[model samples]
Target: MSDLLARHRAVMPNWLALYYQDPIEIVSGKGNRVVDAAGKSYLDFFAGILTNMIGYDVAEVREAVERQLATGVVHTSTVYLLRGQIELAEKIARLSGIPDAKVFFTNSGTEANETALLLATYARKSDQVLAMRQSYHGRSFGAISVTSNRSWKNNSLSPLNVHFLHGADRHLTQFKGLSDAGYIAACVDDLRHVLATAVAGDVAALIAEPIQGVGGFTMAPDGLFAAYQEVLAAEGILFISDEVQTGWGRTGSAFFGIQNHGVTPDMMTFAKGLGNGFAVGGVVARGDLMDAPHAVGLATFGGNPIAMAAANATLDFVLSHDLQANAARTGAIILDGLRAAAPRFPIVGDVRGKGLMFAIELVDPETGAPAPALAARYMEETRSLGLLAGKGGLYGHAMRMAPPLTLTEDEAREGLAILVTALENIS
Candidate 1:
């Protein structure tokens, strides 16, 4: 393990952080559990950073990939006609709920978002974009420019003129005390104010995550985006929903997180869970906007046969097993359990999220200030207890848990028990 760590540090970029004080190399995974190189089995609550939507080593997905391998054709790009890519694109376009929708495949969420941004700018004929504060899009330069989280935003240089808006993080906003409806109204008003003062003309688009993933699962009030959509429509500003983490029924109540806000965006970007750990990401947009790009655009590895096969199989398994319903039911159980445990753990300042995506924000008990150290200790302790969860927040003080959508009641209870014990130990 020491040798591996030394080699990793020597070869990999320093910014690529690994988990745990002693990082454990994961060897294999089945269902909701994974075995580390040390042969210790752990209940994987993070689900490979929420990429394994159904579960690990799903036979259906495995068989699909195996069948594709037997065909001996995998690298056919978008330049060639690939049946799997077409089928997956058709499935996604139909599921997108945008009228006359079209789908474009990419290799990752970051690229998908970049494609959306490019389409938006070209269609709207403007480079000014609006993004929510304390939100994250991706790691690329274009993505980072729109991302408002200071920790993730490495530099100020950007290609687009980006403006950060309020209402993404209610806990840190001035409208925290307002009721839901009042809060939405205040945010909309602030958005209007920003448009008048910041934007010079018609903005390209407003890109947002229904639930801020890296921002600790923070969510705006219900119908908040819908209200913003109404305003954007008046100005011909496009609305882009960054559904990378919130897509594919992980949010429990809906197939897409933006559905929770009762709004259908002009464009939506998805990745992470779609291919069930395989590299597949895409953008779904209206036909007119999708065809707006004049020059030819193509991705080298986009729409590969293997990725499409995996995504097709993963989507099939998710729908056939009704994992969305499972996510809703099990998510409520975990959410309630965490909320109930919050009072007992003084370090827990807030618990917020939807479906399987939830977070526990840590705080100093007396001052109520973010306690990043305590959060780190909690994460380490949880891992030691045979469970693997994730941590995220603007201040790095949130304990994020996004188990597989197929998590059983038994697994949920066991994870809750372990988390409760971890909190007790921390206290």
Candidate 2:
């Protein structure tokens, strides 16, 4: 262990060391399982934050990548005719069923989000960005400026025009003045107020994760987004959905997270699950929006050959194998089991989210406050028992479960059993 640590410290950059990682050294992955250097296998319930939609070490993707490698070099400028990029763009467009839509690929979630912001700003010709409080939208400087995480900004960004709003705060807040319906109504009304009072040419776009991925997997109240869409459309504000975490069948649906809300965004960003663990991200814009002049937004790695091949394979696997429907089916069982388990545990406050992208929020039974410490402890205990879990929510009290869509029924049940054991031990 000392020798390995020495080797890592000697070769790796210190900036990466700033982040916390599990002590175990992962060597490889196969399907829904990953093996450490010591060869211990654990059910990957978190799926690398829900990026491995089709599971790890998928044969089709490996074969596709190998074929691409055999043909020629991986990276090439898209200024020329590129078969991989053209094929992926066509596949994504067909999967989305959108007309004359254009795709802009990038290297990661933040870059994809940054691209979307640029496109929206270019289209609307404004600076202000509206986002939901507690939402996670990547860490790019521009993306972080629009994101509501204060700690991430670190006061480095100047004059950020991010306006934060409550997402389902009507249900969470204890104020007696507003009913639940009225609370949701007020949230929408607040957006309307922002649009009305904010000076013209101030707000560029209203961006949100339709499912609020890291923000406790919170869903907007029914009809909330439809109502919000009306306000944004009337204000000439472009709607941007950051689906970097929720897109590509992880949410048990097709297309964007906004589809769940029954509204279409002017532009959408995607990263996780697009390449099934490969480094690929992209932005899909509406036809009219994409018609905006080029040269304003382009990436060297965007729509490159290797990344595009992986994405093409991932999309083929997802569609042909019905991974989205599988997620929906398996997710229902997990949600039911969790809801039943919640009643038995005093700390389990709520179980919510769409499909595999769900969470079990923990709270102190005595005070009804978020039990973040307890949740962290529970994660450690679960990992010790050979299950990998994730944390979410604003305060990080939510136990997030976003296993690979390829997870079998037995594997899911085993993971849930591990969770139940952890909850029992914590209690």
Model 2 lDDT tens row, 380-411: 88888888778877777888879988888888
Stretches off by above 4 angstroms in model 1 are none
For candidate 2, what is the lDDT?
A: 0.78
Which 10-residue span in candidate 2 carries the lowest summed lDDT? 14-23
Measured over all alpha carbons after superposition, the RMSD of each candidate to the real structure, in angstroms, is 0.8, 2.4
- Per-model TM values vs. the true structure: 0.99, 0.93
Question: Judged by TM-score, which candidate is best?
Answer: 1
lDDT of each: 0.92, 0.78
Candidate 1 colliding pairs: none
Expressed as tens digits, the lDDT of each residue in 216-318 for candidate 1 is 8888988999999999999999999999999999988999999999999999999999999999999999999998777988877988999999999999888
Best by lDDT: 1
